[model samples]
Target: MKRDPPPPPPQPFFFFWGPPTPRGRGGGGGGGEKKKNFFCFFFFFFFFFFFFIWKRRGPPPFFFFGARTRTPPSPPPAPAS
Candidate 1:
């Protein structure tokens, strides 16, 4: 009896699976970048805002840690006769 032709060899893994996916790279990381940039922008904006107010007005009465340490100014000296 005649023998049947052997089956063809299996195809390469990539041929079925398609190109390999990039690892740890692409749109997934965009959110973190945006968050980081937002935080940075917020920090700088508040820093400059407070700095401007400080220049215009002066140091605030209190600080995060505690109240201001400066003592009240003494009254002006009495006028000489």
Candidate 2:
């Protein structure tokens, strides 16, 4: 049978389906080089985060903080009869 070229990519946005989502990837993930690139991104994010904190040489991230909960910002409506 005859065939047509695939459609152009859509603009990125929040979607629960289609490629990389519920519908499953349209085109399967890439080759070795693409996988390498993805790992590279992970490495950069990790290193940059550590470097940013190291440069501070100041107080490390405050991992612990007391509870922040308080009264609701708005009053509830009157209860129905």
Candidate 3:
């Protein structure tokens, strides 16, 4: 006897190729909200990042200890008699 054909694969939760439909309003609304939240997160992240850099008056410090230090210049040699 011939075996039965396999059942079709289940569909994915979201589809990109289909035309927009009124029935998909809920899903589309959720996507729009997610996009808005992503933008807000990045906006605040960059705002704080720049604020820290500006307060330090230079590039952000490394993960190690305090800000970098500079060595003082040597005193000029005394004039010969």
Candidate 4:
């Protein structure tokens, strides 16, 4: 005999509340395959930095690690006699 149609998929426990957010609880795909906030932040920072370096010859001397070179101040003018 022909079998009846399979049962419908199970409804989400809290699906009635909202569609679903990326921040949903575990197993919610929150940590399954999606990227974390830290990664996104890092990605954006590097992306912006890449564009900034391209736009402006490289990061300012201050943003570098280790001691950086400082701009030399103008020499004092010679005293008038």
Candidate 5:
């Protein structure tokens, strides 16, 4: 009885034509990079936008003062002619 030639020594599977998959070390991280760059740009734009608005508008009213001052009372209405 011949032992089926030892099952041809069990060769490992391999694909020669398929594209090589990236592994480790800066591989498959494009999405994260895009997200990071987008967030950075968004943060920068937001900061500058607010800063520009602030500079254009100057300091906010009542920033230091606690409450608004009262206006002087108007004089009584003059007698009707």
Candidate 6:
């Protein structure tokens, strides 16, 4: 007697853009994974970039805690004549 082949795996739910591709030795669905990785990298790059700017330059003037009036430095008194 002969046995039947196993059923294919269920489709993953996260992919909304298109139908699932057939899995094979060449690695199906690799393109979607690259897109996801790119998005993740982009988000983290901006996150760290803004965080670095904030650390180096402090908060923007519009922020409540950063809002402060500027004052000119006072002139030094003249030396005794």
Per-residue CA lDDT of model 3 for 1-81, tens digit only, reads 997555333333433322333333123322434545666899999999988987888655663455565568999999999
Q: Best-fitting candidate, measured by lDDT?
A: 6
Candidate 6, run of 10 with poorest lDDT: 21-30
What TM-score does structure 3 among the candidates reach? 0.36
- Candidate 5 segments whose C-alpha is farther than 4 A from its true place: 1-30, 60-81
Across 1-81, the per-residue lDDT of candidate 2 in tens digits comes to 987555445424422223452223323331334545666898999888877887887435443352333446798889999
**Candidate 4 residue spans exceeding 4 A from truth:** 1-35, 58-81
Report, for every candidate in turn, its global Cα lDDT versus the true structure.
0.55, 0.52, 0.54, 0.56, 0.50, 0.60
- Candidate 3 weakest ten by summed lDDT: 21-30
lDDT per residue for candidate 1 within 5-36, as digits (tens), equals: 55333334423232322321123322334545
- Candidate 2's C-alpha runs over 4 A off are 1-30, 58-81
**Residue 69 in candidate 1 has what lDDT?**
72
Q: Among all windows of ten consecutive residues in candidate 2, which has the lowest summed lDDT?
A: 21-30
Using TM-score, rank the candidates from best to worst. Answer: 1, 6, 5, 3, 2, 4
Candidate 5 structure quality by residue, lDDT tens digits, 1-81: 654332222212322222222321122312334545666898999889878877999655665584545668999999999
Error of 6 at 73 (Å): 18
**Native-vs-model 6 lDDT?**
0.60
After superposing candidate 3 on the true structure, give the runs of residues whose Cα lies further than 4 Å from its correct spot.
Answer: 1-30, 58-81
The superposed Cα distance between candidate 1 and the true structure at residue 61, in angstroms, equals 0.9
Q: Would you list the clashing residue pairs of candidate 3? A: none
Candidate 5, backbone clash total? 0
lDDT of candidate model 3 versus the reference: 0.54
Which is the leading candidate under TM-score? 1
**Candidate 4 or 5, higher TM-score?**
5
Displacement of the residue 61 alpha carbon in candidate 2, Å: 10
> Which tens-of-lDDT digit does each residue in 31-78 have in candidate 4?
322434555778999999888886888555665763567668999999
Q: lDDT of candidate 1 vs native?
A: 0.55
TM-score of each: 0.45, 0.34, 0.36, 0.29, 0.38, 0.41
